[model samples]
Each structure stands twice: as structure tokens, then as C-alpha cells.
Target chain A: MKKLVNNPVNVVEEMVEGYVRAHPDYIKQLQSNDRALVNARETKENKVGILIGGGSGHEPGFLGYVGEGMADGVAVGNIFASPSPDPILEVTKAIDKGAGVVYLYGNYAGDVMNFGMAAEMADLEEDIKVGMALATDDVASAPKEEKDKRRGIAGEFFIYKAAGAAADFGYDLEEVVRIAKKANQNTRSMGVGTSPCYLPQTGEPSFEIGDNEMEIGLGHHGEPGIEKGPLETADKIADRLVNDILADIEITKGEEVAVLVNGLGSTPKMDLYIVYRRVEQILSERGIKIYRSYVGDYITSLEMGGCSVTLMKLDKELTDTIDHPVNCPMFVQK
Target chain B: MKKLVNNPVNVVEEMVEGYVRAHPDYIKQLQSNDRALVNARETKENKVGILIGGGSGHEPGFLGYVGEGMADGVAVGNIFASPSPDPILEVTKAIDKGAGVVYLYGNYAGDVMNFGMAAEMADLEEDIKVGMALATDDVASAPKEEKDKRRGIAGEFFIYKAAGAAADFGYDLEEVVRIAKKANQNTRSMGVGTSPCYLPQTGEPSFEIGDNEMEIGLGHHGEPGIEKGPLETADKIADRLVNDILADIEITKGEEVAVLVNGLGSTPKMDLYIVYRRVEQILSERGIKIYRSYVGDYITSLEMGGCSVTLMKLDKELTDTIDHPVNCPMFVQK
Candidate 1:
């Protein structure tokens, strides 16, 4: 795999430099650290600061959400790898206003451990209040009784939008955490992979599937899925994902929800909409109200060929916050 | 390749339905047509109304730019195909206040023809004034003397930002056209393809390349490229693309430039940053001031394996607009 980098180790640093340089109007890198904050010009002192951290590769998640009415700070890890506690601590400190800071991120093991450590460090160093919420939306990783064990997926968008709005609406740290956790609890996701992806440093696929086969419920780290079968039609594929997710979440009929048909990386928009069409039909038949729908690559696994479906049941608070305005290079509300 | 669409013919309409439903607070579909406008709440009578339009599949382009300080209206077409003239005319009329309207779009045959026809129709029907500018930034499309024949790539972002700023600053239609054209003149892009894309309708690749080979200077529509050779190192790829673009645009030493490392569709960030790493080194060595840089899948070709580099020489006015604040669902300038 021919790559355009100098040294493999420098790829992350250089990429971060370029990202900061590109969006100086919205975000800036903390001094010599792998953490970024919304430009101070746009930071509000009274608003709860929302911070998200995770390994890189999920472009629009951790970093793309940093701007007005979204995330205030983002700490980035190396590709598919966790950032150290120092950067996480730095970001938490930088964004902490008088109100407090909310650390919203996926439920990966490394992320949970590192962010927990960073939260402790920040609590000791400053008078800033801190809270954390884990996004565990993927249904394949856990059973209903073990929902907290599921990995996060593209449903993070809803969590961020809701938590960001809560903060924007002058919610305290605990309030923001409560709302964010509620959004996560109501969200469910499932993914299927048609092709594998290669890690840059390894230059080898993280997982493998046959050319004519696909793996459903694949993890972001390319872990094995629960089901491997022949490539199926979009309708069938959507049915499998929706069935599994609906069964896991046990969404009642006529409930309102937001749907996200996310491309893992290499799936085309046409394909995503195809899956969405089936998803919409299935949900509509169940008398569900789709409050909103998003179709594209929100969270990806490098360039893997796959798509995931995320459904989030919306309450008045989630709906209001999800509709709140966000200004970022990669996302907007209005 | 497997896809998620029900039928290729209905993909665009279905996706548009989902988009408008998802972002009703930010956008609305124009009266049963395939056109969309920024929410009426965001409009002001005296503000210069900026409009953009093009084919679909380029997810964040024409549609994504609609919001405050960006496009006021967007007309969309089928995948990799231009919108019909009626939608373009509808969007123009819908966005045109007493203030003039600016038609900003890529330089594609279908887009130019359709938008041109619509502009003329608008002039014939109402007293509203309108002006159009074509984005021609792909340096690989033609020689210096034939630069006008170049295809627009990711540099459309710069043009959109500049044009949006011009309109935001209350520039008249003619003045907005002038600045947008100037930005296009100062921009250049070049791309490489590891694989070709299949049109959903056709269900076959638009073009083909060998597994070990890549095509350089490929266009967004899967057009034939300037050169085809075995895939090489990421640094070598970046060197080739940057060198060709800089030479084509006659980038001078000490000039300030904004760089965009854009993924065509399926190229991963791991690969994108690898390319950016080398691109930065080459630009730095030339003493060129990189005022800003962007790396992502901006303008895509379905799920193609390729990437493009765009360089725009920045002057005060262009930089100011590029730095100007924008609040939209997909693009936010803080």
C-alpha cells in the first residue's frame, strides 16, 4: 500500500497540523498537544463545554463536531489507536469554563480508561467540574441485558447534537451528561462489511471476508462479526440490520425516532439510500414516526466496504437539541 | 458491487426526501421539485442570495453548502448527472429577492448548459438579476492555453466560500461573479485513481484500471486521466499531483496558497494524511505560505479509490471570505 507520508510515526502529527491550519476560524490545536479546541473567539464562558475524544479515522465525529453549538474540544488519538491521557487532560482543561465540562465519547475500552484517567487528572488540577458519557449504540456487541457493553457507532451524532444543545441551553455538567446518556440509551446501531480495510502502519487488512461474502455486526476495529453470509440485496441487508437492532432495542410501535444510514467508508450514497429506503419502509410499516434521517458516512472504518443503520428514539429534549444549530466545517444544523 | 438502492432512478429523489426531512429546520424542498432552499427563517430581503447546483453523489457539495453565509438555495440532480433546467430556474426564482442572485457551480457540460438555460429563463420572466461563474480548477484536464476546459474538483469549496462571502458582504450579482471567477482562476487541482467507480444505474464501472495501476488527473465523472502507471509510494503520488498542479497554475514562490487534499470517495484518512504529509513538505520547501489546508472526502466519485489535491492562491479578499463565518448543517465557519 503506497502512502504519502514521511515517517509512519509522523502521520498523525502532520495530519493534526493540517487539520488545525485548515479550520483556524473554528478550531485550534492546543500548544504542542494532540488536542484541539473551538477557537476561543467562538467559545462561550457560560455554556457547558462539550468535549469528545477517541482514536482518529472517524473524521466528523470527535473533531468535525467542534464548533459553535457542538463540541468545544476534541482530543485525537493515532489512527484506530487511543490518544494518551495527557492530550485528553489538556483538552478537558482548555474547554472548561465556569460551568463545567462534559466528556462525550464512544465506549471503546482504551477510550474509557484513558478518558477516565484524564477526568481524574482535570478534577485534581482545576476547580472545573467534569462528567463523562459512553456511547454504546451497537447492538451486536451486547445482549439486551448487557446493553452497556455494546460498542458505539454512528449514533454518536445524535448524542453530540443533544449534549451540545443541552450545554448551549445552559445545562450543568450533570444535566448534559444525563441528556447525553438518555440519547445513547435510546439509540441502537448495527453494521455489515463487504470488504476489509488495511491499517496504514500494518499495510495488512484488519479482518477478512470472501469476495462474494459479507459480515454483519462488524466492529470498527475490524473484529469478526456475528454473521457471515453471501452478499445480499440492499433490502435484505437492511432487514437484517433493522431486525437485529429493533429486536435489541425493543422499540414500541408508533414511537418517534431518528434514523442514520451510515456508510462504513467505501459504500456509495446510492447504496446508503437504497438501504434507507428499505429501512424507512420497515419502520413505517411498524407505525413508527421518523423524526429525522441521515444518509452518508458519519462514522467510517477507513475505506471498508459496508454500511450501518442507527436508530435513536427521540424525546422532546433529544428532538429539540438535535434540531439546535451547529456550526462546523463538516456539520451544520441550520 | 452490492449497493443499497432500490432502483437507481429513484435514488436521488429518495435521498432528497430523507435529507429535507432530516433537516427541516435548515432546509426545505422546493414545492415537489428536486430543488431545495435554506429555511425561510434564515433569509433576509436585503442580503445577497447565493445559489449553487450540480449533480448528486457529491454529498456535501451544492446541497451541503446551503446555510447562513453560504448558499441560499441548491438544486440537485441524479447521481453524477446534472439537474434539469426547471429545478435550477425554480431555485433561482425562490432565492431571488430584490437583491440579485449569484449562480455558482462546477464547470460540467450538463451543469453549465442547464444552469445557463435557467439563468436566461429567469431574466426573461422577472426583473431579478443573475450572474454565473464556472469552477475550473482541475489542472490535469487541460494545458495552460486550454485551462477553461479543466474540470472543477474540490476547489469548489474555495469558490463557494468566496462567492458566499461576496454575497454576504452585499456585493451585487456582477461583483460576486467577478470574485468567484477570480478564485476559480487562481485555483488548480489534480487527482489519482486507484480504482474506478460504477454508476448505480449502469451497475458497471464507468472506467477500469489494473489492480496494481493508478490513473492520474482523473475527473469526478470517471473521465479518462492524463497518465496511467503502476501505483507508487504515497509521497511519490503526492509529489506528482502537487508538482503538476503547481506547474499548471504557475504557483510562484512565496505566494500564499490554500491546499485541499480531497478523497474521491473510498480513500481513507490514513491514506489522505499520508498524502498531506508529503504535500506539506513539498509546499514548505517551496517557501509557499499555506494559509489553510483541508483533507477529506470533499468531492467524491461514488465509492471510487482515488484522491485529488486542490491549490488556490489566496489574496486578501479571497482569504477574508474563506475565513468568514458560516453556519450551515454541513459546513460551519466558526
Candidate 2:
């Protein structure tokens, strides 16, 4: 595959540099380091800081949300790789205000281990208060009893928005962490892939699927899904994803929920919305009140052909936070 | 190729519906019609309404900017097809706050003609003043003397931001139109493609290229590009795109500009930022001031494998407006 890059090893560093340079008005590098934080021109005065960190490949996740009313700081790792404890510590310290920092990130094992270490470092070295919330939304990774074993997917949006809002509303670290955990617990997601993505350094797919077949519950790293089957219609595919997710989460009738129909990477908006239409209709038929919906490529798996659906049961607080005004290059809500 | 759509003809309409539903806080349908408008709660407050429209396939164009401090309404057409005059008229009427409306759209012939008709209709029937500006940024299309022949590509973002700011500053229809036209004139874009995207309805690619080859100056609709050659590095590709755009527009040293490194659907963020790194280096070496930079799949061509670079020479007003705060689902600036 043809790629626009210098040395493969430099791709991640170069990308982080360029991204920070582009959005300097909203983001800044952490004291000569690769870690970044939202400019936070007005953040220091009003609330606790919200921190999110993850691998670099998920563009909008770890970086795109670093702006007003979202994450205060984002520690980026290498492409699909975890950031070391140093950068995480740097980010944690940079965004730390007097109140404390809430560390929210996807539930990858590397991220969990690294962020945990960074939290310890922050508490010991900087005398900063910090708490962590793990996103475990992908239902295909584990049964409901093993929810913590599931991998995180697009549902990280809910955790960030809720936690960010809680912090914005002057919640302390414990309160902010509680809200984030609640959001993560109520969120559920499942994904299916028609193809795999080629990692930039290797130039080979992490996993593979047949041209005419799709694998359900695929991880972002191109790991195999729960099952493989011939390509199906939008409705059938939506059922597979939605059924798996709904079965795992206990969303009651008339319960308000926020739905995110996310394109993995290469899926077109047309197909993504088609899947959303079916998913919406099914939810409506079940008397679920969709508080809001998000349909786009928010979280992606490079150029893989697939999408995931994330449903978050919402209360007034979660809804208000999700609707909070934000201004970032990749996402905005007014 | 496998697709998830219910019907090809319904793809655009269904997608628009899904978008509106997802962003009801910011966008709404034009009185049950296909067109959409930002829910300007204070429409009676006499703000100059900004309206943009075009075909549907370009995901973030037209629809993505409908929010605070951006476009007030968007009239969408079928996929890669222009919207008829009625929908444009509807959007214009819905957004008209008795302070005049600025019609901003791409330079496609159909859009120009349709929006022109709608502007006339609005003037005659609603006593709402209207002015139009066309975005013509594709460098390969034509030269300055023949500016009307140039195609509009990803550089439309500059025009949108400028127009939105002008409207926010309470510029009349004529003044807003003039400024928007100036922004378009100062902007130029060039794109290259490694693959063509298949239209959902046709289930066939709109164009063709060899596996080991790429085409430059490709349109968003899978139209033929200017040149075909062997695949090259992202840096080499960025050099070609930036050099062609800068040369065509005659961007001189020390001039401030905004850069957009846009991915055409299937390209990954890592690759897009890699290109941006090279692009920034080239511009910096030339002593050009990059006031702003955007990197992502803003204006996509379905799932085509490619990227485009857009450069807009920025005046102070344009720069301020491009940097202004905006709130929408797809774009946020804070």
C-alpha cells in the first residue's frame, strides 16, 4: 500500500507534532514533551480536570476530544501502542488542578497497566489526586458476567462526555470518577468487519476476512470477531450488533439512551446511516427513548470495512453533558 | 462490492434523516423537507443567515457545518447530484431572519444554477435579499483569468468559515458574498487517489486506477484525475499536492494561510497527518505562515483511497473567522 510518510518509526511522532501544531489554539504540547492538553484558557478557574489517554490510531478519541467541555489533557501512545508511564505522568501533571484529575481511557491491557502506573507516579511525585475509569463496552469480547474482560470500543465517548461534564460542574475526583464509571457501565458496543486494516509499520493486515464475508465483534487491532458469515443486509447486520449489545445491557422500555452508530474506518456514511436506521427502528419498536444519536466515523480502525454501535442508558446529567457545547476540530456539539 | 444500503436511490435521503436525528440539538429539517437548517433559536434577533448547499456524498460539507457561528441551513441534493430549486428555496425561507441570506455552495454547474434560481425566488417572494459565492479551489481545473472553470474541492471549508464569520459580524448579503468570493479566490486544492469509490446505488466504481498506480487532481465524485503514476511515499505525494496548489495560486512567502489535509474517505489518520507533516515542512521552508491547519476525512469521496490538500491565503478577517468558535456535530472550534 502506498503511504505518505518518512521512516515508519517516525510516523507517530511526526503525526503528534503536526496535530498539536494545527490546533494550537485549543491544544498544546506538555513542556517539550509529546503529551498534549487542551489550551484550557478558562479551565483552571472553574473545575476539576478530565484526562484521557490511549494509543494514537484512534484520532478523535485520545486527541480530538481535547478542547472546551471535553478532556483537559490527552496522552497519546504510538500507533495502536500504549504510551509509556512518563508521557502519561506528564499529561496527568499538566492537567492537574487543585481539585484533582479523572483518568478515563479505553480498557486495553497496556493502557490499564501504563495508566495505573502513571496514576501511582502522579500521587507520589506530584501530590496530585487521581482516579481511573475503564471503558469496557464491547460485548463480543465477554459475557455480561465478565464485562470487565471486554475490550473498549466507541463507547468511550460517553465516558469522556459524562466525566468531563461532571468535572465541569465542579465535581471532585471521586464524584467525577463515579459518573465516568456509571457511563461506562451503562454503555455497550459490538462491531463487525468485512475486511482488515494493514498496520503502517508492518504493511500487513493484523487479521484477515474473506472478501464476501464479515466477522462480528472484531477488535480495533484487526483481531478476529466473534463469528464470521457472508455479508448481510443492513438490517440483518444491525440486528447482529444490536442484539448482542442489548442482550448484554439491561436497557428497559421507555428508558432514555444515547445511540452511537460508528463507522470503523472505510464504511461510507450512506451505509453507516442505513445501519443506524435499522438500529433506530428496532430500538423504537422496543419503546426505548433515544435521547440522542451520533452517526459517523467517531472511532475508526484504520481503513477496515465495518462499524460498531454503542448504546448508553442516559439520565438528565448524562444527556446534558452529551449535549454540552464543545469546540474541537473533529467534533462539536451545541 | 458488498454494501449495506437498502436502496441506492434512498441512500442520500436516509443518511440525511439519520444526520438530523443525530444532531437535533443543532440541526433540523426544513419543515419536513429534505433541506436542513441550524436551529437558530434567536432567528428573530436579526442575524445575517448563512446558507450552504451541494450534493450529498460529501459527508461534512453542507450538513456538518450547520450550527452556531457557521451555516444556518443546508439544502442537500442526491448523491453527487445537485438539489433542486424547491429545497434550496425551502432552506432559504426557513433561515431568512429578515436580515438577508448569503448563498454559499461549490462551483458545480448544477449547484450554481439551482441555487441561483432559489435566490431569485427568495428575492421575489419573501422580500429576502440574497447573494451567492462559489468555491473554486481545484488548481488543476483552470487559471485565475478563467476562475469560473475551476472545480471546488476540500477548500470549501475556508469559504464556509469566512462566510460564517462575515455573517456573524452582521455583514449584509452583498458584503458577505463579496468576502466569501475573495476567500474562494485565494484558496486552491489538489488531490491524488490510490483507489476509486463505488457508488452505493450503482454498486460499481465511478472510476478506475491500477493497484500500483495513483491519480492526481481527482474529483470527489471519482472523476478522472490530472495525472497517473506509480505509487509514491506520503511525503512525495504531499510535495506534489502542495507544490501544485501553491504554484497554481501563487502563494508567496510570509503570506498567512490555512491548510487542510483532507482524506478522501478510506485514507487513515496516520497517513493524513504524515502528509501534513511534510506539507507543513514545505510551507515553513518557503516562509509561508500557516495560520490554521485541519487534518481528517472532512470532505470524503465515499471509501476512495486518497488525500487532498487545500491552501487558502488568509486575510486578517478570514483568519479570525476561520479561528472563530463553532459548534456542530462534525466540527468544533473552541
Candidate 3:
């Protein structure tokens, strides 16, 4: 109830309206479906469309990436709830270039079911070829042996960056899907939550956390984590997250990778860098080269206090794509 | 306190160490003084040095801007306290390329005193020319007739951008100071705090408010604002802030201005955009044209829940400079 929203029921719509208003030249609501957002500048002719969609509350994730160099469109759902087939289809239609459209989203059960249905419906009724690429980069969500079963976390940012660059480069839908999958496979993330976030509809937190405890591996939508334990120092927390991510990857001592330290909602950027300090130390000691590093709230749960560390074990292609220039409202890297 | 720090007493130094670790390619600790941060890449020969410094709690504010297209160096201070004269002098010495150095920071007493003393000392002892440019853009901090008495808020971002661009373009010290002053003169801002942020050392909020109330015009470091009242709708809060800023500036019809809707620490990015929605609408209705808009956490108190609106009435020079590409770790516009 402490949130700075109008009516709780109207948070999503207002957020969408405000976002488009704030970035008037960059994004707009789909004429056919207000829940679907598309870049104001139309997708280039004959280029593969890059569409990313997911539940709301993760600002700058699915919607904020809609721009010239990133996602062409996004279908927004209610808070932490998947978009229905309607919005997804609308977005697919809005951003579909002659080459077809590719769908990129987090690997949550609800999202997978919804986006999958949308893709099927688009192909059957609308004659649009929709390719699907799910992000499965959260190392703690599943054992390494079951990597495909892991839910996506902060690594979704890297996937979107790489895939968007590929699509913008005029890659075919299959090629775009390949790069998306490759990016996801090369990425791994793990986080520890020190606070809980409330669902706006219920105005209550889905789970309880102690004043001095931390929830390791909690999902963006309050999913279960490894365990709740007494809060530890920044160095120890960084060790835990970095170790979890390294265990799930095949990074060699001399390999180069991109490091991302992401803050979940209320964690200060200052603290994220503190965590990044340890991440850098461990990687350096292990002889791993950090090709580039990003530290910020790239993706977030609404006001949930914690941080996630993501590493993309990069190949030349992935690194090139990540270094590709982007001009989105939330993130613009040159 | 639920902060992810090693020791509260060591927060500033650790943060400095961590920031350099996180962005080793963009910034480094000064060899003369660890508290001073200099751009890893040296400034172009003879370009006027742009040195920004302030209290430590405002991450990304005074330090994050130190890079190729922004500040040349920064002096880091203890949490919520001005950096001592030593670090300021060290930073000035590190970045001075023989042209001159300019100081850009918020209008705070401690910072003003310390920086002014450093400037004096540098001129007399080190023979370095240092110029001062204060940011006074917070409308709520003082009445329109007493605008110079106001404190600086998020408007400091625009000041830095304009002044940094001027300096980077090889403007003389006087021209850089002129641009910085003009940007400050044309800027206006107001904010509302929904929750208080604690000082890490004290582990207590500097102030308090009821759960249902908010502090209008609250300063970044918990300074007193216009009033404390019941928390209003996002639209109402935006209207209040916008009206206050407009009342203090001569923003006529057909004039272009850049708008910044900044979140103070714990305010979710979603709420910030919701507020921006109304800010844009109000500006449109008043016939004021928006040249560009930025909505994010630019200047923040550590985990304080609030949002501030800033307007920088723009001219062709300011607009061109704003659009100029700058590569900084936290902010990049291309």
C-alpha cells in the first residue's frame, strides 16, 4: 500500500501510458492492442522482427528494450502475470517484417505457455511465422544437468542484447533464434534477495523474510530459492552468487566473459558495485578475463531488495553483438 | 540496517574501491590520494578539466560521470559529508592538463566550503587555476525571488552534461563556466519523499513521516521541504512538482526544454514513469515543448523513496550538446 500508484488495478495501464509518454519519440502503444508496445520508428523492411514480451513490474526489461537496435515490440501483461495470446498476437502482427518475427522472453511456466499459444495461434490463423526463444540462464533454478529447466533471470538482458543485434543485422528468423539460444546458453545468473516484493493486486508480499536473513536464488516473481540464511557480508554474498554461476558454466581459466551485477529493486547501485568488487576479484584470481562489465538495475522486481550477478561466457559473435550500439530509452550504449 | 556493506565506517573507501573495480576501464583511484577518482583515459591535451565532487551517498552522481565525455575527475567523500580539501586538490592536480579545472557540484554548504578552500589552495600553492560553478535549481528549496538560495537536486545532471560537453569541446575555462551557469540558471526541480533514508553510520533515518504521508520538496540528504502531507496520487504528486518548478521558471510557449523525472533511491522505476506521464501532459497542455526527456534514478539519496522533476529550458547550443554522444559507465546517449 506504500507504493506511489493510483488505483492498484490501474498500475499496469498507467505505467504503459507513462512510459510511452516519457519516450514519445521512441515507443508507442500498438493501435490494435494497447498492451502491446512497438517502436515508433517502424522495423526495417524485410528484416526479422525482434519481439520480447513478459509480465509487468520488470520495467526496462521487456518494454524498455523496444528501440531501433533492440526489441521491435513488446507485449505487456499484468504484474508478474503472463500476457494473453491476444496481446502477443497483436505485437507479432505489429512488428512482423516480411522475414517474420522472433519471440524472446524469460523461461517462466506462465510465460512459456502463453507465448507458445500466441506463436501457434499466429501461425495457424494469421499466417505469421513466429519463432520462440526462451531464456534459461538462472543457474539456481535447476541443477546443471537440467539446464534447460532453469528459469531465466538477469541474463535475459544479455540474451536480448545479443539477439536484438543479430536481428537488426538482418539475420533470418532461424539465425536470430540460433543466436538467442546461443546467448542464453552462454549466460548464467544467480541472486540473493534480502526483502520481499508485494503483488499489487493483493497488496501483500507472497513470502516473508527475516530482518537479518537473505533468500538465495529467489526469482523475480518471488519464486523459491536455495535456502534462507543469516545475512552475510558483501564479499561472502558475492562469493555465493559467483560460485553458483561458475558451477553451471564451462568457463575456462583463460576465457573472456562479460560480467553484469544487477540490483533487484531496492538494492542501491553503490552496493551492487560492492558485490561487483568481489566478483571481479574472484574472476581475476581464477585468470578469467572480464571483456566488459555492467552493474545496475537492468532488470528488477518491484522494490525487492537484493542483487544478481550474471556472466555471459562469450564467443566472438556474442561479444560483437553485445558491443553493438544500442539506442533504447533505458539503456543506450555506444 | 539491511545494507550490503562490510563495515559502515569503511563504506566510502570500500565504495570507491568497488567502483574502480567495477569500472576499471573508465575510472581509477588517484595515486596521490585514494579518495580522488580520475578518468582512466586521460583528458585530451589542453582541454579544461571538469572536476565534480560531493558527499559519498550520491552514487553515480559525482563519480559515475567521470569518463571521456563527462567529468575528468572526482573527489569522493564520506557518506553525506563533503570531501576534505586534500582529495579535491589531488583530483584537481590529476586532471589539470594546463588549461584549468572547473568544479561542478550541488549547492551544499560543506561541499561549497571544502571546494572553495581547495580552489584557493590550488591557486596559491599548486599554481592551478580552478573555477567554481554552483548548481541552484531546486525550486522548492527557496522562493522564486530567492532562487539563488535554493539547493541543487537532479538538475545537476544537465549542468554537468552541458558544462562537460563545453569543456570536452575545448572551450576555455570562462566559456565552460558560462555554460555551466546558464544551464543552472535555466534549470528547475522539485521532489517528494515517501520514505526516509538512513545514514549508514547512525543506522537511523534522518527524519520520519507517517506511512500515509510524504514530504514535498525534500532535499536529497533529508533537508526540510515545503510541507508534509498525505501521500497523493502519482498524477497529483507530479502536478505539484511540475507546478512548483514552472512557478520558478519563465518557460514560455513554443520554447523547448529537456525534462528529467528522477527517482530518489527506493522509488520503483515504474512509479517514476507513472509520474512522468502527468509531467509530460502538464507541459503539453501549457504549450511548453519538450526537446528531450530522461526518466530514471539520476541523483539519489541512499535508498530513500521519492521522485524529483527537473526542467532544463534548452537553446540550440544546449540541445546540440545534450545530443552529443558521451560514453560514461552509468549514462550513455548516442
Candidate 4:
């Protein structure tokens, strides 16, 4: 309720306007539909078009990832609400350079339905080749037997990075799709939410929890998680999240992996690193080699207090794809 | 307190441990003193050593900025408290190349006392040449006639970047000092806080406000600000912060400046951008061109809800130095 927003209904429009203006060198909203943000300075090269989209609360995701060597286009929606097919189709049409467009985003019902509809429309109506790569990497949302039913969380960053880099490397549409699938298959994430986020329209929290309690395995959109319990120490939290992710991902001894200790929203970077310290200790003791580690708020729920840990089991291809340079506003690499 | 820390007393040490381990390739603690985080992969070349430090809670601030083309060393203190002279001296000795070491940090009483003592000891005992550049860019903290009395806030980033880049370009200590001074002179910042951050040891917020109120010009350590009022619209807040900053700085028509709308920990990037929308519109209407802009949580108070706006009036020299490539975990520039 203490948020610095104008008419709550106009948060998306104003945020998009400010985002495009702030990063004028990196992104611009489409003239056809202001909801679709594309690379400001397109190279016009015939690389596979990487298009990402989703709800808007998770800043620096979906949109901030649109730039050189990353997503070429991003369709934005209302807070925690998926964009309609119209914006998705517009972004796909605009960024496609005859090399086809791949729709990338988290696995949510509204997003899947809307993006799927956009892909169908692009293929049938516009004669444009379109594909979908849904991220189902949050292991806590489902049992191992129902992996595909798991919701996407912070692991979307790695999936997007690898997929975007593959497209940047001029991989064909099918090859890009393959890389996305591989990234998603190898990535696993789990999160605990200590506090809930408010809906801008209602100015009320999405859910309620005791002040001293936290929800384990909560989804990004405040979805119900596996269990609720009293908040524990950083080490215990790290143990739980890392153990859950490792149980789902087949990272073995001497295997190289990329790790992401992501803050849900309001968790400080200091706590995330403290969590990462335990995660490193856990993995190192298991003889797993960390190729690279990212610790920050890569994805988030609005003002939610928690953290998520992501482990991406890596091979040479996955490593190289992720290592490829990206020049986005948030996830920049040289 | 709803925080993920093990022991309040050991928070700083553990956070430092996690930080060094997480970024082993970029930084490390000095062997003699764990509080001094130095560049892990030091270049033996005799470039001027750029050292920065302050209290702990501001993650990515005092330590996250240490890397290639940035601060070569950082001395960390406990949360919101200045480091003792021992770690400061250790960092100075470790990173000091033949060109000498420069001490850069915010202008606060405790920091001045500690870092000043360190500089004196380095000169009198160790014979290592040391200079100091204090950041005093918080416009709301002082009157125009006494700008030097203002507290440093997010503007510390620009000052650090310019000074570090100058040193990386092999500038002499005097020139680097000049650049740092110039960056500070040209930069101005203002912030509002909706909630207070808790001190780890105290296990309570530094200050308290009504749920519907906010403090304008709140200091990073939860110090008193200029005014307290009802939480206003994002646009209104943006107008107030921007107008105050512009009035203090002599930016005229056709002048170009870099803008930074930074979140104070818990505020979402969505609201920051919403604030930036009005900031950009106001400056544009006045014909002041934006050279470049950065909007995110570059510096933060742990779990504080608010945002800060920083404007750095740029010239050719300042622009080049600010744009210089930096390879740090948080502030990476290609």
C-alpha cells in the first residue's frame, strides 16, 4: 500500500514508458503496440529472433533482457498477469528476420495459453515460423515424476541466456529450440517466500502469512507452495533450497554447473551471498564444480521476502552458449 | 526481525566470507585482515590504486564496485558503521602500486575519522602516499552555500567510477583526485524512504514511520530527512526529487547529464521506472539532454522501501571516465 505508483491501473504504461526512455540505446517500444519492447538498435542481421515475454512485476526479466546477444523483443503485461496474444504476435512479427522467432517465457497457464495462441496465429495468419520454449525449472512446485508441471522461477535466467546466445550464434530455429530445451532440462530452482507481494490494482497482499512464518516452494505469482513453516537461519534455508534443487537435477560428482542464488524481491544481496556460501559448501563437499555463479535478484515477486537457488547442470555446449556475450541492461556480458 | 542471518553479531564477518567465496575470481580478503577485500587477480603493473570502502549493509556498494577499471581494494566495516583503521591500512598497503593509493568513500563523521586515521598512518609509518576524495552529493542534506556538508548517497557510484577509470587510464594520483573531486562537484542526489532498515545487532528498524507516510531525503543509514508526509503518487515524488536536485545543480538548456533512479532495497524496479518516467519528462521539457541513464538498485539500505534519483552533470572528461569499461559482478561495462 505504500508503493510509489500513480493511478494503480497505469503502472504498466508508465513503467514501460520510463523503461524505454531510460534505456534508449538498448530498447524501444513498438509503434504498433506500446506493450512490445524491442531492441532499440537492431542490427537487421538474419539471426534467429529471440522473443521473451511475461508478467511485469519481475523487472529486468522478460524486458530488461532484451538487447544485443539476448532477447530481441519482449512483450510486457500487467503486474503478475500475462500479456495477450496480440502483443506477443506483434513482437514476433517485428523481430523476425526471416530466420523465425522463438517465444520464450516462464511456464504459467496464462502465458502458455497466450503465447501458444500467438505462435499459432503467426504460423497460420502471417506465414511466420514461430516456436515456444516454456521454462519449467522450479523443482519445488512438483514432484520429480511431474517435472513438466513445475512452475518456472529464477532458472528462467539461465534458460534465456543460453537460448538467446544460441540465437545470437546464428543457430537455426530448430537448433535454437533444441538449446532452449536443453537449458530448461538441465536447470532446477526452488524458492522460499517469507512475505507476500501486493497486487497494484487492489493495494492488498496476494496472500497472508504469519509474521514469523515462510512458505517453501512458492511460485513467482504468489502461488501456493509445498509447505509453510517458521523462518529458519540462512544456512538451514540454503540447505533446504539447494537440497531440493539437487534432488531434482542429476548433477554428479566432478560435474560442472552454473549456480544462481536469486533474491525473491526484498531479500538483501548480503543474505543472498550468505545463502550462496552454504550452497557452495554443499556442492563443493559433493565434489561438484561450479563453473560460474550469479547471486542477485535476477527474477522476483514484487516486494516478496525470500530467495531461490538455481543449479544448471552444464556441459561444454551449455557452458559455451551461456558464456556467449550478452549486452542487456540487467544481464550484461562482454 | 524477518531476516536470514545466523547471528546478529557475526553478520558482517559471515557476509564478507560469503562475498569473497562467491567472487573468488574478482576479489579476496587480505591475508592479514579478512575485513579488507582486495582484488584477487591483481595486476602487478604500477597503476594508481583506487580503494573504496564504507559500512557493510550497502551490498554492491563498497565491495561490489571493486574490480578491473574500478576500485582496486575495499575495506568493509560493520553495518552502517565505519571500518577501523587497521583494515583500511591493510587494503592501502595491498593495492598500492607505485602510483600510490587513493581513499574514496562517502563523507560521514565516522568514516572521516577512521579513513583519515588510516591515511595519516599510511603516510607517517608505512610511507605509502595516500590521497582522499570524499563524496558529498546528497543535495537535500545541505544548503547550496554548504554543499560540502551534504551526505553522500547514490552519487558515490559516479564518483567512484570516474576516479577508478581515471586511475585505470594511468592517471597520476593528483589527476585521479581531481577527477573524483569533479565528479562529486557535478553529481547531485535525493532519496525518499517509506520504511526503515533494521540493524543486525539491534534487531529493530533504525526509525519508524506511519504506514501511509514517507520521509523525503532520508539518509542511507535511516538518518533524518528534510520532510515527512503522506506517500504521494510516483509522479509527484519524482517531480519533487528531480526539482530539488535540478534547483541545486546549474544544469542549463542543451546540457547533457547522466541519470540514475535507484531503488532503496525493497522498492520494486517497476515503481522506480514509474518515477523515472516523470524525471525524464521534466528534464526533457527543459531541453536538458540525457547523456545516459541507469535505473536500478546500485546502492541500497537493507530492506528499506524507497528510491533515490541521481543526476551527474557530464562534460567530455567526465563522460569518458564514467563510460570506461568496468568488469565487476554488479557494474559490468563492455
Positional deviation of B312 in candidate 1, in angstroms?
2.6
lDDT of each: 0.81, 0.82, 0.88, 0.89
Worst lDDT run of 10 residues, candidate 4 chain B, spans B39-48
Candidate 4, which segments miss by more than 4 Å at Cα? none
**Cα lDDT of model 2 by residue, B255-328, tens digit:** 99989999988788878887888899899999999988889877887788889999989887788788777776
Q: Write the per-residue lDDT of candidate 3 for residues B1-334, one digit (tens) a residue.
A: 5888777788888778878987788989988899999989987789999999898777778788888778999998888888999999999988889999999988889989999999999999999999889999999888888878889889999999998999978899999999999999999999899888878788999678897899998999999988999989989998899998887788999999999999888888888888888999999999999888899889889898989999999999898778867888888877
User: Residues A1-334, candidate 1, lDDT per residue (tens digit)?
Assistant: 5444556666667667656656667778888575555544545887788888788877666677788888888888888877778888888777777888898888888998988888888888876788888999988887889988888888888898889899989988889999999999999999998987777677788787886788999998897789999988778999999999888876788789999998888887656766887888899899998887777778887778899999999878889987787777567556
lDDT ranking, best first: 4, 3, 2, 1
Q: Which stretches of candidate 1 lie over 4 Å from their true place?
A: A1-9, A24-51, A67-75, A89-102, A116-130, A165-173, A250-255, A277-287, A324-334, B30-51, B72-75, B90-102, B116-130, B250-255, B277-287, B327-329
Please give, for residues B1-334, the per-residue lDDT of candidate 4 as tens digits.
6888887788888888888887788988888999998888884568889889999889878899999989899999999989999999999998887778999999999999999999999999989999889999998888999988999999999999999899988889999999999999999999999988888788889788998999999999988999999999998999999999988988999999999998989898889889999999999999999998888889999989999999999999999997899898777887
For each candidate, what TM-score against the reference?
0.86, 0.93, 0.98, 0.99
Stretches of candidate 3 off by over 4 Å are: none
Q: Mind giving the per-residue lDDT tens digits that candidate 3 earns over A77-132?
A: 89988998899999888888788899999988889999999999889988999888
Structure candidate 4, residue pairs in collision? none
Q: Among all windows of ten consecutive residues in candidate 3 chain B, which has the lowest summed lDDT? A: B320-329
* TM-score of candidate 1 relative to the true fold: 0.86
Question: Rank by TM-score, descending?
Answer: 4, 3, 2, 1
